[model samples]
Target: MVDELGARFATAGHEIALVGGPVRDILLGRGSKDLDFATSARPEVVERLLAGWANHVWDIGKAFGTIGCRKGEWVLEITTYRSESYDPTSRKPEVSYGDSLEGDLSRRDFAMNAMAVLLPSHQFVDPYGGMEDVANRVIRTPGSPEDSFSDDPLRMMRAARFAAQLDFTPDPAVVAAMEAMADRITIVSAERVRDELIKLVISPQPRKGLDLLVATGLADHVLPELPALQLELDEHHRHKDVYEHSLTVLEQAIDLEPRLGVELPDFVTRFAALIHDIGKPKTRKFEDGGKVTFHHHDVVGAKLAKKRMKALRFSNEQIDQVGKLVELHLRFHGYGTGEWTDSAVRRYVRDAGDLLSRLHVLTRADSTTRNKRKAEALRSAYDDLEERIARLQEQEELDSIRPDLDGNQIME
Candidate 1:
């Protein structure tokens, strides 16, 4: 299928090459199913050629010169050389086609993604030393980082995402550019920002991406709640800063559950991890004795998470799951310390409902602290709680715990 597509593009007097993530992954010796091809040919030409051989062809982004062609289970994305210019307010770009491969490479978001390979010959083209950056596990822009990022502030998030995904660091210049242009991210749509955030949180090392967000000042613009979480009391409480603690929680979540299968449940867990402590800022209080307390922080955090999710236009199911997770995050800790009563456990089971396992994963992630003994003890308690819940479930004790208990039956 690849060969046939290659031949079709080749016969049209255009140089077609596998590019972007597919090429990057292939060079890194990783398996990639999404195939993307860069072509010197125009979008229309590419579409016409693919239409003859492929069963399905779509102009997913024809205005920006992209065409999607599918053959059976295999899908290929083809795009002509293009450059984009953005208005100050919206992330949607004003795109124009370029005539050469250099133009396309120059316009890419990162050096690692800029690298392309000739399809038939399988020869890599690294115009901006993308190959060297990829080999060294660095993420740099193709040209001036300032110009590249200014053209699209969302690239700042993408840079962090690549760092997390590839376990690389952004070039110093790129990092500086990201910091300088952090506020500009507000101009981008919340949906675009959310998508990038999701990708970063799901990466192998989510902390790397999140740290970059905090460091680059993007967090202040994208998620101002984080900075609010950083406020500290004098010396009363030794709890870590809320932002740092959240990152720790995210790292722990990724560690505890490395692979969350592609589904709504997985995304909910990740989103919950990111916003689990969101209420701390709103609930913070300093007592007369200098004791710092975040009373009802979980409830406040859940409210904040709902607002943020709504701003991002998350699906209703996703919003509900994340909000529920944030609200009940502190429940497991309470269960660990207090009585694991049947009523209490039943309440948890009812609240969690279909999301019990996901909630458990979130609880495990939330146990990150400097106190190793405390953490371990909590883990053991959690395991016991799980066992108890399982036994209760097996005995059908929870079956009748539903809210629709029969007042009519009682009357009868």
Candidate 2:
């Protein structure tokens, strides 16, 4: 579908380039199949040109000058050069068409993405020194940082995501702009915020991206729970601030296995790590000797996670998975002791069910601490518990511990 559309656009005498991440990734020697095209042709003309070659065409964002073409398993997006201005109260843009590719590139969110390549000839066009920015490992917005983020607050999240994904530092001015306009993020849709966050958390340097979010004050607007988790206790008896600990867990989770062949994307696990300890603030208590503990924080955190997921308009399945992971995140660490009873393992397996492995990953991440011995001990215990669960399953004890009673089965 990409080839067909590319050919059609090329033949139409319109300058089209397979642009954005696809070209950027190719230059960076990374794999990317998502194709995007930038052209001087108007959106309507591009639509008409693609209609002949593409059997499946949809104007998914025609107002923003985007049209999608699909042929079999491949899909390509063709967009015209355009510029936009945003209302102060909404992320939705008021658009204006641009005569030159430079105008369009100038309006893009990041310098790396602002670069383009000409189709057929494969010549690169970089007006904003995006290639240089990519080479320098820096993320900079096209034109002014304030104008870029003010036009779309979601760009702040995108900055963090690109930083995480590309292992680049955002320009200091851009970071300051993000901090100043953090409250403007509320104008963006929850779904867009969630999408960017998912990408950020899934990236290799997820903790870096999250730290940036907190540092820039963006989390206070989009994820209030995170900043609230930063509340301090009176003494050393308290654990680390929940917000800092959450980032630590996220880093540790990625460091532990680094790879899980689960069907869900890496971002989901990252998101779970970010919110796993959310209940701690609400559950905090001061005992004798200034000892601070969060009793039943997992249970409370699960409920808070669900609310956060809902606020972000996450899918029902995603919300449930994140919530479940938050609720049982602590179960694996203590499983090697008396908690390793056959019945306990069965219940653990049953509670976690399809998410058992992911929960283990989360638990491993959650055990982050300064004490090397404790960390090693937790890892050892978790290993033993996993082996014990396997042995129990082999004995068929797990299979027989169904929740369905004999009377209920007979009634059915």
Overall lDDT per candidate, in order of appearance: 0.82, 0.82
Give the per-residue Cα lDDT of candidate 1 at 378.
Answer: 84
Give me the runs in candidate 2 sitting further than 4 Å from their true place.
Answer: 1-11, 51-58, 70-74, 231-238, 256-260, 332-340, 397-412
Q: What is candidate 2's TM-score against the reference?
A: 0.87
Per-prediction RMSD in angstroms? 4.3, 4.6
Among all windows of 10 consecutive residues in model 1, the one with the lowest summed lDDT is 257-266
lDDT of 1 by residue, 1-412 (tens): 7777777778878888888898789778888889988888898898889888999999888887889988998888998877666676677778887777777788888888888877677777888887788789998888899887777889999988878877999989999999888998888888898899888877777778878888889988777787677776467465567877777786677666644444532667876887898998788887777767889988988899998888977888888899999999998867754487898998999999877877888898887667899888888888888888888787785566655658887677
Q: TM-score: which candidate is best?
A: 1
TM-score of each: 0.89, 0.87
lDDT of 2 by residue, 1-412 (tens): 4445556777887777777888778768888878788887888998888777776888978888898888677788888888777687788878877777777778888888888877666677888888888888898987889988888889999998888887889999999999999988998999999989888877778777877888999988888898888877576745567777888887777765544676444656778888898998899888888888889999999999999889999999999999999999877756656556788888998999888778878887887678999989887887777787788777786567756578768789
